[model samples]
Target: MNKRLLAIIAAIGATTIYGINHTVAKGIMPHYVQPYGFIILRVLGAAILFWLISPLGPKEKIDPKDYLRMIVCAFLGMGLNMLVFFKGLSLSTPINSAVLITTTPIIVLVLSAVILKEKISSRKILGIGIGLFGALGLILYGSEVRQDAPNIPMGNFLIFLNSIFYGSYLVVVKALITKYHPFTFMKWLFSLGVLICLPFGLEEFMQIEWSSLPFEAYRGIAFVILGTTFCTYLFNIFALTQLKASTLSAFVYVQPLVGIGYAIFTGQDNLTLIKIVAACFVLVGVYLASRKPNRFYQKLK
Candidate 1:
């Protein structure tokens, strides 16, 4: 198959893993393990996996000048991105996390325009406005009292912050992905992540009562480390090699559909009228923001 098709599949695979992770990862937090501690496990585990497989990829040395960019990418993509996300998930509903994550396309669009010097058409600007409005609405008003979710507004805000970090990472990593093998880029990226996150998570990581944890919690942790962190990053990095950052980020549109459906099916979260409406706004905004201007105008013609 063509590289484009393979990239699409990789992006979709990553999105699917992330969608399910909303619930699966959340199931292990604050009780079995706190959010920051879980991040340590994720980064450390993925770092080890990446290192183990790094030998198979082409041996290419990174330019010394690119070291700073790699460190920034690690902080944005793995450290702060995962840290805030899991913390947000621990304090927010699954559906809320799912819906909020769909805004990544919009965030990527804005970041691309600013950092990558990509053009933003009128439609995209309007989409950004509408998308931010929907996201802000959800953050301000989408509260529900639940045992699992302690601070819904704060959680939603943190999740939004994660979108920015993650979106920025996508745009910034594009250049590095072009220069280095995904294995090479990711191994170092995650190694840096371990150091960045270690200070915050070490105390909590030590507090875990591993012997007392149930089987399901162990399964959840394993899935998070193996599937969510390792596989998803690999898939996304591969996808980035063949797709634009915006195009790869656009695949986040599938996340809420998969995440919400799984959450509802598993009895982890439910939808409300406000959530439904906010989701509509965010999805429409994402569609507009990610649509190519030439293609959109061609359809009009």
Candidate 2:
């Protein structure tokens, strides 16, 4: 297959995994592993999986200078990013958490402009503004979610913080991945991410009730490992090798639509006119931001 087709396939696969993983994590897995513990295993499992696929040895000669830059990306991207998000997920309702997290793309665009010196077009900026308005509407409606889901406002705050780190991770990935092997970067990134995250997560890991948790908990754990932890990041690195960070991060806006669609399919949420309108705005905004300008638009200018 051509590189473009391969990149599209990878993006779809990654987005599906990420969207479903949120449903599983926020809707299901909190039944067993607390947030921090869950994140630890995610990193640990991903670290092991990447290692099995691409062995990391002390003898590999990645210049410490370059490797260290990637390590900082890991610290911000995987380590602290996961820390804040799972903490938020642990403390609050998934609907609010997921919806608030959608704002990352807006944050990402601003950060990209400032940190990476990527130029933002007027159309993209307007899209981001509209996307934020839609996201806020979701957040307002999301607060009415049934008490079955947790509502830790602290968790919500952390998840937003996670959005920042995640944005930074992408910029760094875009800058570095071309010069290094994607798998090489993945192996070391997760390895260092685990190391950076360990201190915060270790206490929670020790306290988990492994014996009492159901066998199904293990199943959920596996879903997180395969879908959320390993594949999502790897797919990201793979796609970013071909596409820019802005293109990849644009996928963030589509996730809520995915979540809502899944909810409707499972009979968990009723499809409403308001939600349809909200979803359309988000999609329109994302399209304007992520896609290249049309020839007609360029000619008009």
Candidate 3:
């Protein structure tokens, strides 16, 4: 199969895992493992897995200049992205987190325009606006007083912060994706992520009562380490080589669908008409935003 198809599949797979993670991770946090502790587990486990496989890939060395860039990717993608997201998910409903994550594509578009100086067509701008409206609509109407989610507003805000940092990470890492093997970059990126996040997570990590935890909690933790972190990040970084950052980020639109489905399946959330409509807007907006410009428009220009 062509790399493009493979990249598209990778993007979809990564987002699907992330969508499910909203509920799975929520099932374990603030009880079995707090958010910070879970971040530590995710980064550390994924980092080790990347390191273990790095030697199997090409043995190219990273350029010294790119080291700084790698560090920034780690800080934004691995550290800030996961830390805030899990914290927010802990305090927000899975469905709400799912909807807010759909904003990532818009953030990516803005970052791409500003940092990469990528030109945006009027159609894409309209798509971005429509997507933003849907995302904000979800944030406003989706807020609920749940037993597990205590602070919907604050949690949603933090999740939005995560989207910004994650969007910036995609733009920042695009240049480096072609320079090194995915495993090589990931090993270093997550190593730095662990170091940077250690201070905040250590206390929480220490609080885990490993022996007393139930089997289900263990399964949730393992799913986060193996499925959510190791597999998803690897898939996304690999896809970045074959697709534009905006194109890959557009897959975030799938997360809400995936997340809401999982939530509904598990009897954790109820569906609503407003959510259905908001999802429609986001899906249509992402399609328009990620599409290649029309040939007629190019010719007319």
Candidate 4:
């Protein structure tokens, strides 16, 4: 019970931080630079934060195979995934971006089953069907649903790819995490990520025109560092010690509602009858996907 409580608190904290970051980033993205440029900075910021804040401990040795997997994890988790997401966020509205990314859980389910041999259950299929219907409805009904808006469509699609890469990274890392401390795991992940992202980051950095924007534009980068980049994942790390990833997956969806509330607060968006219905569907889906059939439920009298 205590563990569950702690996990809930951590997940809530993570979601709140993530929610705020989305709002913050939405405000700053177009003001400063392009998505690729923002992501280069975001990942580098996370790299620095993880290194400085991470603790030193006795190291656990692992196979070369594990190290290779960590490299792939870095590419998918930090490098490519972030690049796509930030770019997408820059092009699309924050609400649209958030809604698209919610597909991460579904991706995780499919990837885990194929790669990790985890079984797909009936409840997961039903939850996905319900949630996807709601999400897909919104996508189709969005103000500019046509692909003619290249930036918006591109951004939204990239976020979906972001979900896939992120989900796959989780399955990949699950093998190595038990053998390593979180800090140690992060060290390898970030270090490898820095190199993989260098090619893209370098291109972005070179193309940026520092003179075009005032120093204030850099504020978004800092927000990415402190509010969104560092804090949200730290909250997730805290929760991992207490809860199963499945439970935490459901909690991740809470960020969408958090995002909707942000939009309302900022006057950027208001809850519509349709969106309310969509939110309810997403909530129910997350609830169903997060839970496994309990032994008590199975053995019901």
Candidate 5:
């Protein structure tokens, strides 16, 4: 199999986990475990897993300067990304969260141009505008008050911030992705993740009443720790080795479809005409943004 094909699969797999995660992780929050506390569990569990498997990858030493970049990556990707996302998800519906996250690719495209000096064609810019419009429409107009979602507006804002943090992380981590094995990179990023998340999450982490929680709650927690955090991050880093950050982030377009499907299948959410239209906009925008140039154009360039 081609490495780039495998990377696409990896990126798809990561988004699939994330799609399910909107509901799976939400199933455990506030009632069973608070969001910040859940962040601690995810970071700690993934960090441990990364370290345990680190020996399987080729041994490599990090350049001293790269450690700083790694820390920033950890802070953005693992710490703030997980922190704000979970907190926001807890206060928002699964469908809304799913739809808004598609903003990541646009953010990634912009950041890549600014930081990496990557060129953006006019088509991509138009796609970004259309996608942003759809996302913002959903954020502003799609409001359904649920018992679970306490503050949809604030939650949506935080989720948007989470996308920004995650988009920035993609660009930052791209610098280091090819320099080390996935295990080596993940181990250190997650290790620093534990430290960066500790202060904000510790008090909430201490508040959990462990023994009294139900099996479903435990299942949710386990899914987050193992399926969402560990596997998704691992898959994404591997994909990064073969795909550009913009390409990888473009897979976020799949999240809402998968997320809404899972949400509907599980009776957690309902579909609306607005949502369907927004999903179309997002899908088309992603296609336009991620499309490759013709062979002639490629050769000319």
Candidate 6:
């Protein structure tokens, strides 16, 4: 019941939903909805949900100076991040999306060092090299010609770019979370996200024939909008209040385990030798990059 434990649980819950989303969201796109159109539903749905509950949190107004930072966070965290990721998922395998997203912790580590002035160790630097090597290998050579995945390489690349945007958002939003309630921050963040992303998604959003879609499609869409977008972001924001950005981001290591397992279980994706090997490199790299410095080293210093 302590804050740290709750934060850990929240981070785990968010990552688990995201892991499953690799398959669930992908199932809804290009057929039930295009990638951009799906993002519109996600942002718009989450915005409404957040606004509905905004009154439960303490009443507080954001400082005018913070508006720019909030807008930037909205764009990075929700707008381009979600847009690029869902597009990539539509064009790539669930396992690939899962593995590629593991790079987020590494990106967060680097960003934290640069933006937050967190110290970086040689071990973490080496881990970065190894992780990027695996990610790049997957992007360059993990291509497969499948009915579902049209362009694997490009999709993987976009997913990688999404990690950068998402990682940056985590670091940037750390300051804002301290100043405002999670509900307040999230409602406005998602509201701005609706405005930022609506233009790109409106045409596709309108094309959907809601009544014609099957039940499975509806389930997938609901899971994405409610579980993936609304819940994950809310959980992560609450987690951030009690944990460091780097610490919270490190929990992304859990994604591939849940994602790959669920994907295989549901027959949505299968693991290749290359995928297995690349995943090893990423997991090892993440372990190195995310581990805390030894107390002995600190004492020696």
Order the candidate numbers by TM-score, best to worst. Answer: 1, 6, 5, 3, 4, 2
Query: Model 3, range 98-149, lDDT digits (tens) per residue?
Result: 8878777667777777865778888999988887777777667666767888
lDDT of each: 0.86, 0.67, 0.82, 0.69, 0.82, 0.86
Off by over 4 Å in 1: 1-11, 237-250, 293-301
User: Candidate 4's error at 297, in angstroms?
Assistant: 19
Off by over 4 Å in 5: 1-12, 235-251, 293-301
**For each candidate, how many residue pairs have backbone atoms clashing (under 3 Å)?**
0, 5, 0, 1, 0, 0
For residues 17-43, write the lDDT of model 1, one tens digit per residue. 989999998788888999999999999
By the TM-score metric, which is better: model 1 or model 2?
Answer: 1
Superposed by TM-score, candidate 6 places the C-alpha of residue 217 at a distance from the truth, in angstroms, of: 0.8
Q: Each model's TM-score, in the order given?
A: 0.90, 0.80, 0.87, 0.82, 0.88, 0.90
lDDT of 6 by residue, 1-301 (tens): 8999999999999999989999898778788899999999989999999999999999988899999999999999989999999899899989999998988778877877786577788999999888998898889988987889999999999999999999888777867876888789889999999999999999999999999999999999899889988888779868877887657756768899999999999998898988998889888887897676333211111
Deviation (Å) of 103 in candidate 5:
2.0
Candidate 1: 10-residue stretch with minimal lDDT: 292-301
lDDT of 4 by residue, 1-301 (tens): 5876977897898887776666677776655666666777777777777777666655655578687787888888888898888777776667776666667766666666676576667998787777677666555554453232246656666766788888777777666766777667776677777777778767766677887766656776687777687777777777877776556655666788788778679865555566577667756765575466332211110
Residue 214 C-alpha lDDT in model 5: 98
Instruction: Output the better candidate (5/6) by lDDT.
Output: 6
Candidate 3 deviant stretches above 4 angstroms: 1-12, 235-253, 293-301
RMSD of 3: 4.3
Q: By TM-score, how accurate is candidate 6?
A: 0.90
